[model samples]
Target: MIRVQARTEQSRLMTFASPLLAIVLTLIFGSILFTALGKDPLQALHVLLIMPLSDAYNVSEMLVKMGPLLLCAVGLSLCYRANLWNIGAEGQLLAGALGGSAVALAFGDSESMWVLPVTLLGGIASGMAWSAIPTYLKLKFNSNLILTTIMLNYIALYLLIWAVHGPLRDPMGFGFPESALFSDAALLPVLSDSGRVHLGVVFAVLAALVAWFILSKSHLGFKIRVYGADEPAATYAGFNANGISWFVMLFAGALAGLAGVAEVAGPIGQLTPNVSPGYGYSAIIVAYLGRLHPAGAIVSAVFLAILYMGGDLAQIEMGIPIAVVGMFQGVLLFFLLACDFFIRYRLVSSRETVA
Candidate 1:
C-alpha cells in the first residue's frame, strides 16, 4: 500500500515547473490519443502546435484570439486571488455582447465618434449587471456562488440566443439569428491589414498590465491576498470581505464584458448566436496555468490561442475533429491539477510507511 503525505514545505521550483510538467504530460497524452485515432502522432502534434505560428496571418489570428482569453483570464486571476470562485465569465461576456449590440443597433447608420465608446460602455455595464446578480445572491443570501454563476452562464447564453432570434435579428438577412452588421463607426479599428487583429488586442494587454499592478502593488491587492490567505486575520485587520468580493466580481465582469463587446465590434462585426468559441471557459485554464498571475496569463493565453488556430488548421488539414481542441484543454487542466497535487505532497511506499 501507498500513503499520501504532505511535505513540510512546498518546493519553490515546483511553482513554475508544474505548468511545464503538465504541458509535457498533455503532449504525451495527445500523442497516444492521436496514435489511437489512426493518425500519425508526430504529424498531428506538428499540425496542432507548430503550424499555427508558422505564418504571419495565423500569428495575427492567434493574437485576435488571445485578446479575449487574456482579458477573461486577467479578471479571473483577480477573483481567484480574492478567494472568490466566480464561474460565470462566459455569461457575463454574452451579456456584454448582447448589450453592446443593442446599443450599436440603436445607432443605425450614424457616424458619430461616440458610437464605439458608448457601445463598449453599454457592454461593460451589461456584464457588470449580469455578474452583480450572482454576487448579490452570494452576499445577501449566502448562496453558492459556483452554482449561481454556472447557472447564469446557461441563462446568459439562452438569453443571447433569444435576443438574436427575436429582437436583435436582422430583418434584411432572411431571418438569421443575428443582429445587423455594426457600422464602421461602432467597430474596433483594425490593427493589421493581413489579419483580423484589432484594437481589442491593445485593450487586453492594457487590462493585463493594470491587473498585474493591482495584484502586485496596490493596497487592495494586499487586502485581497490577506483575505484569501487567512480570513480570520483579514477580519482582525478590519478588512471588509463583502466589499472586496463586490470589487473583484465587478472588475471581473467589466473586463469580461469588454472582451465580449470587442468580439462583435471587432472580428465578428455583428451579434451572432455563436459569438464565442467558449473563450470564457478556456480562460479558466489559462488563469490556472498562469499560476493565477495576470502577466503569466498573457503567456498562457498566447499558447491557448495557438491551439485555437491549430484546432481549425487540424480540421482542415488532417480531418481531425474540432472537439479535439476542447479535449486538449480538458486534458491540460487535468494534468495541471495532478502536477500541482504532486508538488504539495509525496507518496510513501509500503515499506517506508511501515518503517
Candidate 2:
C-alpha cells in the first residue's frame, strides 16, 4: 500500500527551477505539435528560437515587441503579489491607448516634445480611472472583482471602437477606422533606422527596475505580501486590505496604461481596434511565468515577445498556422502552472511512501 506524505521542508529548489523546467517542457510540446502538423520540427524549432536572434533587424523588432509585455507584466506582478485579482488589464490598456491617442491627435501639429509626457500621463490616468470602478465595487458593495473586471474589458473595447468610428476618426482617412497619422513630435524616437524599435524599450526596462525596487525594498511591498499571504492575519495586524487592493490595482492599471501609451506612441502610431494583439492577455502569462516577481516577469516578457516575433518568422518560412503561436504560449503557461504544483507537492514512490 502507498501512503502520501508531506515533506517537512518544501522543495526550495523546485520553486527556483519551475520556470526553466516549464520552458523545456514547452519546447518539447512545441516540437510534437509541429511534427503532428507535418512540418519539419527541427527546422521549425530553429526558426522559432534561433534564427530570430541571428540578425540585427530581428533583434530590434524583438525589443519593440518586448516593450509592452515588460511594462504590463511589471504592473501585474504587483497586483498578483497583493492578492488583487485585477483581470481587466486589457480594458485598462484600451483606456490608456484611447486617452493617449486623444492627446496625440489633439497636439499632433505641435512640434513640442512635451506631447509624449502628456500622452503618457493621460494614459496612466485613464488606466487608473478604469481600474477604480471594480476597485470601488469590490470595496463598497462586496462585489466580485474577477467578474466585474472581465466584463469591463468589453466596455472599454466598445468605447475604443466608437471613438475610431466617430470622434477620433481621421477626416481624410476615407472611412478607415483609425485615427490620423501621428506627427513626428507625437512619436517615440527610433532606436534604429531600419527596425521599428523605439525608446519605449528603455522605458519598459526602467519600469521593471522600479517594480523590483518597490516589491523587494519598499515597506509597502512588505505590507502587500503580508496581506496577500494571509488576509486574516493581515487584518489582525492592522493592515487595511481595501487600501492594499486600491494601491495594487491602481499601480497595475497605471503600468498597463503606460504600455498602451507606448504602443501607440511607438509602433502603431494611432488609435485603432488592433491597438493590442492580446498583449494585455499575454502579459498575464508573462507575470505568472516570471513567478510574480518583477525581475522574473521582465525575463519572461522578453521570452514571450520572442514567441510573437518567432511566430511571424515561422509563418513566412514554414506556412504554419498563426494559431500555432498562441498554442505554444498556452502550452508554456500550462506547463509552468503544472510545474508550480510540484514545488509544494511531489510524487512519492510506493516503497518510499510505504516505508
Candidate 3:
C-alpha cells in the first residue's frame, strides 16, 4: 500500500526550480514523441524552439503574440492569488473586443485621438460586466465558478460570431464576417517602423509592473493573501472577503478586456469572430508556470509566445500541425503541476509508515 504525505516544511529551492525541471522534462518527452512519429527529434525541436528566435523579424512577431498573453496572465495571476478560480478571462477578453469594436465602428471615419481611449474604455467596461455575472452567481447563489466561467466562454464566442455576421458586418466588403477597418486614431501606435510590434506590448509590461506592486506592496494585497490563506481566520479578523473577490475578478476582467481590444486595435486591425488564438486559455498555464507571480508571468508569456511563432514555423517548414503546439502547452502544464505536487508532498509505503 502507498500513502501520500505532506512535507513538514516547504522546499524553497524546489519552489524556484520546479518550472525549470518541468521544462527540461517536457523537452525530453517531446523529443521522444517526435521520434515515435518518425520525425527527426532534433530538427523538430529546432523548428519549434530555436528557429522562432533565429531572426529579428520573427522575434518581433513573437513579441506581438506575447502582448495578449502577458496582459491576460497578469490578471489571472492575481485572481488565482485570491483563490477566486475565475476561469472566464477568455469571455471577458471577447467581450472587450466586441465592446471596443462597437465604439470604434461608431466613430466611423473620424480620426480623433479620443476615439482610441474611449474604445479602450468600452472594452474594459465590457470585460468588467462580463466578469460581474459569474462573480455575482458565485457570491449570491454559490455556483461553481469553473462551470459558470466555462459556459460563458462558449456564450461569448457565439455572441461575437453573431455580431460580426449580423450587426458589425462589413457592409462594403460584400458581406465578410468582419468589421470595417479601424481608423488610424482608433488603432494602437507601432513601437517601431521595422515590425508590427505596438503599444500593446508596453501596456502588457506596465500591467505586470502594476500587478507586482499591488500583490507585494499594498495593504489590500495583505488582506487578499490572508483571505485566500484562511477564510474563517479572515472573517474573524474583519477582512471583507466579498470585496477582495470583486476587486480581483474585476481587475482580471479589465486586463483581459484590454488584451482583447488591443489585439484588434493593434495587430489584427479589426474585430472578428476569433480575436484570440486562445490567449486567455493559454494564460492559465502561464500563471501557474509563473507560480502566480506577476513578474514571472512575463518570462512565461515570452516562452509561450515563442511557441506560437515556432508553431507557425513548424507547420510551414516541417509539416507539423499547429494543434501540436497546443498539445505541448498542455503537456508542459501537466509536468509543471506534477513537479509542484512533488515539491509539497511525497509518497511512502504504508508499511513503512506503520513501522
Candidate 4:
C-alpha cells in the first residue's frame, strides 16, 4: 500500500527547490499541450520562449513589460507576507491611472518639470484611496476582504470606462474612448531613443531594493512576519493587527498605482479604456512564484514578462491562440502549488509480509 504523510519538519531545501521543479513541470506540460494541438512542439516552444530573447529590440520590449510586473509583484508580496488579501490591485491600478490622467489632462500644455512628479503622486494617492474602501469594510463591518477586493476591480473598470467615454474623451479622437495624448513633460523619460524602454525600469529596481529592506531588515517587517505566523501570538506580543492590515493594503495600492501611471506615461502616453493588459492580476502569480520575496519577485517578474512577450510572438509566428498565455500561467501556478504540497508531504510505501 502507498500513502501520503505529512513531513515531521518542513523541508528547507525543497522550499527553494520547489520553484525550479515547478518550472520543469510547466515546460513538460506545455510541450505536451503543443503536441496535443497538432503543432510542431519544438518550433512552438522556440517561438514561445527563445524567439523573444534573440535580439536587442525584443529584449528591450521584454524589459518594458518587466517594469510594471516587477513593481506590482513587489507590492503584492508585501501584502501577501502580512496575510492581507488585497486582490483588488487591478482596481487600484485603474484608479491610479485615472487620477494621473486627470492631472495630465489639466496640464495639457504645461512644460513644467513638476508635472511628472505630481502625476505620480496623484496615482499613488488614488490607489490608496481605492484600497481604503476594502480596508474600511474589513475593519468596520468585518467583511470578507477577498470578495470585496475582487469585486472592486469591476467597479474600478467600469468607472474607468465611464470616465474615458464621458468626461475625458478626446474631441479629436472621433468618439474613441480615450483621452488626449499627454504632454511631453508629463511622460516618463525614455532610456533609449531606438527602443520603448523607459525610466520606470529604474523605479522597479529601486522598489525591489526598498521592499527587501522593509521585509528583511526593518522592525515593521518583523511584526508583519509575526502577525502572519501567529495572530494570537502577535496579539499577545502587542502587535496591532488592524494597523498591519491598513499599512500593507495602502502600501500595496501605492505601488500598483505607480505601475499604472508608469504604463501610461512610459508606453501608452495617453489615457485609454485599456491601460493594462491584466498586469495587476498577473502580478499575483509573479508574487507567489517568487515565494513572496522581494528579490525573488524581481527575477520572477522578468520571467513572466518574457512569457508575455513570447505569447504575442507565438500568436504572430506560430498562429497559436492568445489564450495560451493564460493557460501557461495557470499551468505554472498549478505545478507550483503541487510542488509546495510535496514539500510538506511525502509518499510512503508499506506492505504486509503475508497478508
In Å, residue 52's CA in model 1 sits off its true spot by: 0.9
lDDT of 4 by residue, 1-355 (tens): 7878789998877878888899889989989999999989899888877888898888889989998888889888998898888788888889989988988788888999999999888888988888899999998999998999999999999999999998889989999999999999999998875669999888988999998998999999999888988889999999989999898888888888888888878889999999988888899999999999999999899989999999999989989998898888988999999999977887776553224
**Would you list the C-alpha lDDT of every candidate in the order shown?**
0.93, 0.88, 0.91, 0.89
Model 1 scores a TM of 0.96
lDDT: worst 10-residue window of model 4:
346-355
The estimated TM-scores of all candidates read 0.96, 0.96, 0.95, 0.96
List clashing residue pairs in candidate 3.
none
In Å, residue 155's CA in model 1 sits off its true spot by: 0.8
Q: In model 2, what is the error at residue 299, expressed in angstroms?
A: 0.9
Tens-digit lDDT string for candidate 1 (35-55) = 999999999999988998898
Show where candidate 1 strays beyond 4 Å: 1-5, 346-355
User: Per-residue lDDT for 33 in model 3?
Assistant: 90
Cα lDDT, model 3, residue 177:
95
